[model samples]
Target: MSSAGEAPSELTGAFIEIAKVTDLGATGESETVVGNTTADVSISKDQTNSETNKHSQRRSVRTKTYNTLDIEVPALLVPGASQLETMGVVDSDGEEIYGDVWDACRIHIYDKEPATASSPAQTFEFENVEWDWSEISLPEDYGEISFTGWVHGAWRRGKTATS
Candidate 1:
């Protein structure tokens, strides 16, 4: 309703966003965190570009803030899977990390079971699984993403004492 004569229309669609991982450990080629219906992975690699001289170039890593960036992830109707809601920056110690240029990439998967599980619970089921990675947007600050307040409870069991 409006003062004079106006009408508001309803919108339908899921909300998604991309966040830059501000911090992460300086070492390790890849890291993955599995959830009930989603899995987030981050890959680190050395980067060299003409814009930045070889010595001046810095190391960069690809990290997913959330396993499922899809708001309607569950609506996808995949069985034996849940929806991923949030994602945070990776924990980096501010060291020289490297990966293949352009070719190398990190992928987020929505597996049926959690990756931390000893083994896949069942042989196979109608677990809805989908994956996609948003582009990385680095910030001006420098620091490895610490798991200080990061949420790791996307699974039934809770975050491990040490990530």
Candidate 2:
């Protein structure tokens, strides 16, 4: 188990991947395969805190607001590429075209260097996920694209690696 003042194992060589819920067969069952194409991945859970003060006493409560997932991958040039295409965008006629906008998907993060045995991986199931925004940067070395989305409803299952 984890406790305060202990630093968990760092996710140095972790990876992230996403798959459309519809990709699953009629039974809606599939295995999570982490993508190696993505260069970076970030996941965060945000909450709204409300504090009540009553006559020199203070009370506070926290409510889960939403979760956000950001993925950065190399811009694909091939037609109907795998990673970018699955993210609701496809290369059409030498132009980027939007594909299915509203689709449910699952995002998986696998921590290769877990702090403990229990912190192996985490999965977040998002419903009604749509493309929020993306950015392309032209640097001296190479070009990269980042995609961000707002998860309507998210369910997370995992355990933090403990010391």
On lDDT, the leading prediction is 2
Clashes of each: 21, 0
Cα shift from native, residue 104, model 2 (Å): 2.6
Q: Write the per-residue lDDT of candidate 1 for residues 1-163, one digit (tens) a residue.
A: 1132211111122221112121122233232322222212222122233332355558554453333211122212111111111232222443222211111111233223333444332211111122232332233342112111112212111111223
Candidate 1 residue spans exceeding 4 A from truth: 1-27, 38-72, 75-86, 89-117, 121-163
lDDT at 1, model 1: 10
Steric clash count of candidate 2: 0
Per-residue CA lDDT of model 2 for 38-102, tens digit only, reads 23444444445555556665665455454343323333222224544454455533345543444
lDDT: worst 10-residue window of model 2: 1-10
RMSD of every candidate to native, in Å, equals: 20.6, 8.5
